[model samples]
Target chain A: MSTPALDATLAPAAGAADAATPGTARARTTAGLRGWAVRLGSLAVVVALWQWLTATDARVGLRFDRLPSPTEVAAEFGRQLGTGVYYLDLAQSMIRILTGFALAAVAGIALGVLVARSRWIGDLLLPPIEVVRPIPAIALVPIAILVFPTDEQGIVFITFAAAFFPIMVSTRHAVRALPTLWEDAVRTMGGGRAHVLWNVVLPGTLPGVFGGLSVGMGVAWICVISAEMISGEFGVGYRTWHAYTVVDYPAVLVGMASIGVLGWVTSASIELLGRRLTRWLPRGEGSAR
Target chain B: MSAPAAEAARVDAGLAIRLEGVSLGYGPHAVLDDLNLDIAPGEILVIVGPSGSGKSTVLRAIAGLLTPRAGRVLAEGVPVTGPSPDRAMVFQDDALLPWRTVRRNVELPLRIRGVPKRERRTAAESWIARVGLAGCEDRLPRELSGGMRQRVQLARSLAGTPRAVLMDEPFGALDAQTRGEMQRLLLDVLRDTLATVVFVTHDVDEALLLADRVVVLGRGGIGCVLSVPDPRTPDIDRAGLRARIIEEL
Candidate 1:
């Protein structure tokens, strides 16, 4: 919202220069391909480093020998992909993440708007949320188990607790940070309070909201996996812990890799959705990340 | 007469807006004090003043964006309690929604008024063309130049067919040439519509060029109100008017 005053002076000059430069399809495709190449290259380097370290049986001060080799982990990963149990665990974890994150999104945004728009709500609601928010999801494990009747509900509660704070805090700030002039503009155009909320506040806060959603998705994955490992019979985290207990080191690595991929995919989906929603905004350099 | 009928009759009257003894302040600091002004229908009233003279405050009050501490602001002969669609404002920053395209931004007023989609699109397109931004419909506000964004703001304010348009330093950020062109375009658009305009600017020359009546505002209220016999006609001494306005400021 704060397009600086200097930008007003400089943007026209830069925009005019861009207008002169022909944006050919070939050039655009080439740039996009280069972007993908860089991403893949970084991933490849990390994988190569992991493979080399495992092949060498690299020792870090005392105990790096316990890590499974890349080939061993890959073989276990392939074996897991062929089995029904691994697939079931994957599905269970994803369902928990999805349902919990969705619940958090709805409640966090609703409560955030209430607290932001009403001083009375802020006074009564914000203080309690603030106090509860600081207690980490891991710390709530005992309390969640005691409160919820089922283990599944307890894990879901932990996931929701993990994701809620980021979304709520971001939304409250986003709502508060809305430029007053946009509201005034809508009001002057004969828009009522409802119109202002629908057209101005909602849309104006979207970029910030999407930012929170992406962060919340990642946090949900983390907390859900942790909760599952601590108390669940199903899910990637529970299976990984079971594998470690049974001395199946490679299978543990496979579970860890699955969680990483799922978390990456969910966060990437959020970022893609955000881009689609805010396509009207100008994409500045270095903003792709 | 019934309440609705009486209200319609009042709107039909020649007087478009009136501010009487309007005083506003933030806590202890006073911005406007005892300001009184009347704007006739279809008249171009320009307010000029130095910084802190409350010119922008006057526009806000007239637009019903501000409630005066001591007095009343009337629109279409009715006391202004809050913002009404009959009034539109062009902010100094050209406050277009960043997430909306130029066409959608221009259509905002009509959309808010619940005008159907097809009609709103047609009206928005016409206003986009009117402001000489026809091809830039799908572009975001950030993609356009400062001058172009201001033109969009002008088109948007006029698109609503607002009875009274309030402008607050709308072109204060534009280059001199662009400002002149916008001023001409504004007058051209207003000539065909029955819109009452109240434009606030710090530029005295701009006020003189576009205003039917140039209001010189000081710390408290209007220090002087100078009428330009006709802005189109050059019968009045332009240099003298500029000098007088400069002296008043």
Candidate 2:
């Protein structure tokens, strides 16, 4: 009934500590470091289990043979890095994914805002999006190849197709879900429609839009890989497919590791950007988790 | 403050708000019918009634958030069309943007009005300090307690410098002590400004504590308007006012 009283009581203790000395800041930093160490220790245990499975002779149909050990994959990565072809392929793959992702983000957000604000646009465009959204991005590979002249264009198209729907749908939902009072508040303050869109509606929808972008990036990676494996001249996905054809299981594992790391880095970058843009957002671990 | 000037600007002037033969309905069912009331300028008018007594609807009509099927709403002799800068509302939920710091939240109306940045920031900072959030200007709304957030909301509405303020159970979500402090703060703020206030509340004590004239609504129209014999002050007896309102109810 009176949580403010409890908070008021606790506030003084924190204020006292803050005023006492600067050492409290260092102490908090070290405590955060300790938390990170615990998380890393658990990750090490998982790596140890993987190593043990690979070192032992497993009798399953495709245990260590098909799924190469971490060490084996690492060695393959080292050799590939020395040749520098792997880096080139990695760069090409990243460019394709990023370019397609950027295009999707722009187009999706624009269309989403349009549909959310106007009923006529929503009626005209929403049905087509809903009808096609359920069809997998991978399934678009064949269609992309038929529609585009080159393999590169086809793969990029597939990646774009993968990311666009999620971002669009999420943006639309976010726009619609904004509190009606916010718009009224802006209007009362003499803001026009354009001003409201730029200042209030866009900022209000960022959290949800970024949520969609994160998911879209993950799916974009999947589709990019599948598209490359099907028809790419040279890419991580193509190399992985080639390794499988030649029975080079270690090389295949290395490719999978490369894809995973790339996906993680890209997604994390987008998340960081989101946080920077929404700096006014309240502190909570719920969004990150 | 000069009582002569205050009376000339408030009591001596005609009604600031007039709702005449107002009827409102949603599709089929009428919520308010044949309602009429007049609130003097610079007066704190509290509307108290049962759950579905259209107390809030009257405020909504005045704010132009809702339209009445019949009759008219006027503010300062001008017909109310929609939400305007002349009237500001403090919602029940505080409604401070979670992403904005206290200072930024208070500056929202100014920013929308395209007020110069330096002037807006100074105004916002002054109000932040006014509401007792001086040291926490950079803190987000989530970082503040419920009472602090509500204080920020009040500061935001005040920053606009509207002719009148509409508060729809603004302290209804707060605890008893916090609510009391807020009521006192509201009185303090009202004393310093000429903004006419239309407060809607179900709490009899709250109605008595903050209002100069308490208007009770029964089914649709005004049941009664009780003028407090004593002017609003920090030391008013809540128990005495509550007994008076309960008897009327």
Residue B70 accuracy (lDDT) in model 2: 93
lDDT of 2 by residue, A1-289 (tens): 1233333444555556666765885575477568768878989999888887788856567566346788887898899889877988899899999989999999999999999999999999989888989999999877897999999999999999999999999999999999977676666555678867986789899999999999999999999999999999888999999999999988998899899889988988887788777766665532311
Interface C-alpha RMSD per candidate, 1 decimal: 1.2, 2.2
Compare the candidates by lDDT and give the number of the best one.
1
Note the DockQ of each predicted structure. 0.72, 0.37
* Top model number, TM-score: 1
Q: Residue-wise lDDT of candidate 1 within A1-289, one digit each (tens)?
A: 1223334444555555556764644465467568768978999998888888877878878455778878889898998889999999999999999999999999988787778889999999988898998898879999999999999999999999999999988889999998898889989998887988889888888888888898899889989999999999999999999999999999998998899999988887787677778766666642411
Each model's C-alpha lDDT? 0.85, 0.83
Worst 10 residues of 2 chain A by lDDT: A1-10
Runs in model 1 deviating more than 4 A are: A1-60, A285-289, B1-15, B234-236
Candidate 1, residues B1-249: lDDT per residue as tens digits? 256977765553333788888898767777978888888887889999998888888888888887889989987779999887788899988599877889999999999888999999999999999989989999888888999999999899888877778899999998889888988888788777767889999998788878999999987679899998768554566888899989888
